[model samples]
Target chain A: MKTFEYRTAAGLAAGLEPGAVFLAGGTNLVDLMKLGVATPDVLVDVNRLPLHEVSGLPDGGIRIGSAVRNSDLAADHRVRTAYPVLSQALLAGASGQLRNMATTGGNLLQRTRCRYFMDATMPCNKHRPGSGCPARDGDHRNLAILGGSPACVATHPSDMAVALAAVDAVVQVDGPAGQRSIPVTGLYRLPEDTPERDTVLEHGELITAVDLPALPVAARSTYRKARDRASYAFAAGSVAAALRVADGLVADVRLAFGAVAPKPWRAYVAEEALRGQPATEERFRAAADAELAAARPLRDNAYKIALIRNLTAAVLTALAEDVR
Target chain B: MRLTVNGAQHHLVGLDPRTTLLDALREHLHLTGAKKGCDHGQCGACTVLLDGRRVNSCLILAITQQDAEVTTVEGLGRRGEPHPVQQGFLDHDGFQCGYCTPGQICSAIGMLDEAGKGWPSAVTEDDDLLSDREIRERMSGNLCRCGAYPAMVPAIRQAAGR
Candidate 1:
């Protein structure tokens, strides 16, 4: 790892200089630094910043500070009772130790777990642009099946982001340019020509908080993840769904998928198909299929389609039953 | 930087920003109780308590935790008086190689505190039972290559008074 100068940020705008990186719950950044993937010359400790609260917004929403640990957010009574899906997603992610150290913003900025991306020796477009994407033809079973470009096919490995996308969350940021609010759905970019850039945020932009708008149906939501192990592993495919069935009809529904795309894919197609439709297994399957129709799966990852279909159906079915 | 470990303050100078808390404890302070199984945080061998919460020491930079309180396995208990979790591990023989024991013990101590505070695991279904499945799921970060989970589960259960 490259030696760097470390200093605590006395204020928010102090660490937005070039070649400087904000450090908060260094679980992901430190790991990448050790692998020589991240080489920042200045480390700005953001843990001391005022971004540590999970407070209620005046607009009947929740504003989770960027530095709030994953464990604390998951255990927050407001989140558990109002947004069960977020809590479940956070818990379903990393282990107790990791969740305790990982922060909300850091979790959202997690890099892809593609083997080539992590290994500096391998040829990865995300690691070094124009090099080539080895995962396209090698060990792509866990690669992206949607929103993937020819240059990259890596999946975003974040359960929390999936839930946040489903809830229509918004991220507040402070940067050299200025402060701006980005919808969670618009936060990530497709693995297009530039796979190195994960989010649309600029070099010196810092996330301040995540705003979750209040939705009554969110209280009836849940997150489901399927992985190789029962725990402590990234999702093979996951679903975050919030449904409100009225008179056997889908009144309102929010759906998102994880580990199947370059970003937390809000299932807008499925949501459009499900709204006002009858709450039935056939309809659920058709809605999932409609969203998955655009999936361009690779040879090794065709199984993800079926796995995600089952997961979506099962989650929607459970939510529909709970509402009934 | 000054690190407060187990209620003891240790001041050090000229430390690299790349040094991890685990390296600081094992190398600078000579407290090698926390093992470094996987420096990438894949394994929980470097598990320690930061502000009374379990975290992978290898994943946190030493300079970043200047204001936090760190607790390693050595601070849990001494030989004559073992912590309840340590005693439980001993009574159940929770290890075959003992390489991952320190991490398992520190993690168990922290897990109990979390469970005590009503923090739910992924498998927790609106209850505080602390079942065997819950224990295994909670400790999934700490891998025992020797397959000591069969005994480790009971040890943690006993420690949790289940």
Candidate 2:
């Protein structure tokens, strides 16, 4: 491996190399480097940029610094009490030691854990654009069934991000062209034609923090993941849902799915179906079916459609009950 | 970068950015107690204490960690006396292969510290010490292919004075 210039967060934009990548926790970036998928010449250390604070925003929302470790973010009193879905999503990811080291920025920018993406030998459009996607025909059981173009079919692997989508979180980024705000929904573009771009973030853009608007309905949210194993396994399918039901009528709701799409899929149609509807399993099932109607599954990934349907229905039903 | 590894200060000036804290410890410092089971962060074999917090040394960049008090397995015991965790592991026969032992010990220390700091877990109430089931959940990160969990729990429990 070639050595690169190392510097602190100061003058980060000025010091950017052609292939420079910010090194936060090195959980995903280092692994990608080892796999030859990412060969950055410089790795700027952003761990010491005084961005670890979890502060309360004026909108009654919370602003979480990018450098904050996943463990600290999950255990923060405000996060646990106010955004339990986000906390639960964080806890559901990787092992304890990894979460202890992984920062919020790194976690959000994590590459897919897909086998093809990690193996340089395999033909992957995401790793090497236009090479060809071998996963479409081989070992694609774990790949995406939604928002997949012929060029790519990989899924976003972070659990924390799925919860962020449901709550409509805003990402604050600092780049060469000054600062800009991106909604969580717009952060990840569908893999319609640009399979190479996982996120819409421009090059040299550094995520400073994530701004979360206070949503009381979101406080009742929960993240439930079904994995191959009990621990250290990526989600086979997962749901982040927040439901507010009053007198058996859905007052408000939000829904998002993970490990089922190229990005954290905000179930907009599903939410539209649930809004003002009677809180019941029939309505929940119908909502899930409507959102999944456009899913284009490969030969090996048809199981995910059932998995998402059942899981979404189950989570919505549980959230709809008067169990608060 | 200067590191206070196990209470000893050492300066490394011309290290590569690709060099992990694990490589620095096992190769340069000759502290091989923290085994490199998997070069990737999936395995906890190279676990160590960074400022008294447990982290995978294999993924940590040494240059990024300036002045961090790194406590490895070599630093746990006093001159001739074994650390309580070491003794506990021995008394309970926590390992048959012993490759993941150091990580388990260090991680348990870190886990106990976290519990004292009121960290929550799925199995127990927030901030409580590991219950019998919670022990398995908390230590799930440290994989022991030797199937020594029956004895390992006793060892960690003994060390924790439970």
Candidate 3:
């Protein structure tokens, strides 16, 4: 690892600059630095910043401070009771120690687990632009199945962010320009031509908090992740869904997928297909099939389409059964 | 920089900012209880308590933990007076090679605390029972290549009662 200057800032705007990076939980960034993937000139320690609370918003929402640890966020009573999907998603990811050390903002900003990206020796467009993406034709079984480009096909690795996308969470950021809010779904940029750029945030823009809107239907939500192991592994494919049924019909629904795309894929097509439709296995499968119609699976990852389709149907069916 | 470990304060001078907490404990302080299995945080052998919570010491920089209270397996107990968890492990023979015992013990301590606080795991339906499945899921971060998990579950359950 390279030696760098370390500065502890009192506030968000204190010492942020061009090459200076904000360090929060240091789970992802520290690991990446050790792997020589992320090299920052200056490390601004943001642990002492005032952004550590999970407070209630005036609009019946909750504002999660950027530095709030993932374990604390998942254990928060309001999140557990009201936004169970978020809690379940956070618990389903990493492990107890990692969740204890990982922060909300850091979780959202974590990079993909693509082998080509992590390995400095491998040719990855995200690691070094114009180098080439080796994962496109090599070991892409765990790579992206949607929102991929010819340049890159890596999936975003955050299960928590997938749930946030389903719940319509908004991220509050403070930078040199000032403060602004970005919807969680809008926070990430698809890996199009520029796979190097992960998010829409500019350099020195620090995430302050993530606001989750109060949706009562989210209380019935859940998160299901399929992986090689029972725990402590990244999702092969996952679903975050919240369904509300009224009079044997789907009244409202929020759906999102993880480990399938460059970003947390909100299943808007499936949600659109399910609205006002009778809650049944056929309707659920059709909705899932409609959403997955855009999937262009690679040579090794064609199984993901079926896995995700079955998972989507099963999760929605389970949620729908909760009401009957 | 001054670090507080297990209640004692140590003032060290001219330490590199890039030094990880695991290196600081094992090399600088000569406290080798926290072993470095995987420096990338993949293995939990470097697990230690920071501010009463378990975290991968290998991933954390010692300079960043100047305020936290660090705890390792050595701080848990002494000769002839093992911590309840340690005693349970001994009674249940929770290891074959014992390489991952320190991490498993530290992680177990942290997991018990989390369960005590009603923190739910992914498989937790009502937070009522800390079943063997819950224990396995919670301790999934610490991998024992010797496959000592079968005995470790009862060891943890015994420790949980005490």
Number of the predicted model whose DockQ against the real structure is largest: 1
Can you write out model 2's per-residue Cα lDDT over B129-152, one digit (the tens) per residue?
577677777777888888888998
Tens-digit lDDT track of model 1 for A146-206: 9999999999999999999999999999876778999999999997899889999988789
Docking class of 2: medium
Q: Candidate 2 vs candidate 3: which has greater lDDT?
A: 3
Off by over 4 Å in 2: A11-15, A322-324, B124-129
Candidate 1 fraction of reference contacts recovered: 0.92
Cα-based TM-score, every candidate: 0.99, 0.96, 0.99
| Per-residue lDDT over A1-324 for candidate 3, one digit per residue giving the tens place of the 0 to 100 score | 888899897677564777789999999999999999998889999999899999999989899999999999999999998999999999999989999999999999999999999998888999899999988779999999899999999999999999999999999998878888999999999988899999999888899999999899899999999999878999999999999999999999999999999999999999999999999988988998899999999999988898888898899999988899
Compare candidates 1 and 2 on DockQ and give the better one: 1
Candidate RMSDs in order? 1.0, 1.6, 1.0
Worst 10 residues of 1 chain B by lDDT: B125-134
TM-score, candidate 3, is: 0.99
2 versus 3: better TM-score goes to: 3
The clash count for each model shown is: 0, 0, 0
Better of 1 and 3 by DockQ: 1
> After best superposition, candidate 1 residue A241: deviation in angstroms?
0.1
DockQ by candidate, in order: 0.91, 0.67, 0.89
In candidate 1, how many Å is residue B120 off? Answer: 0.9
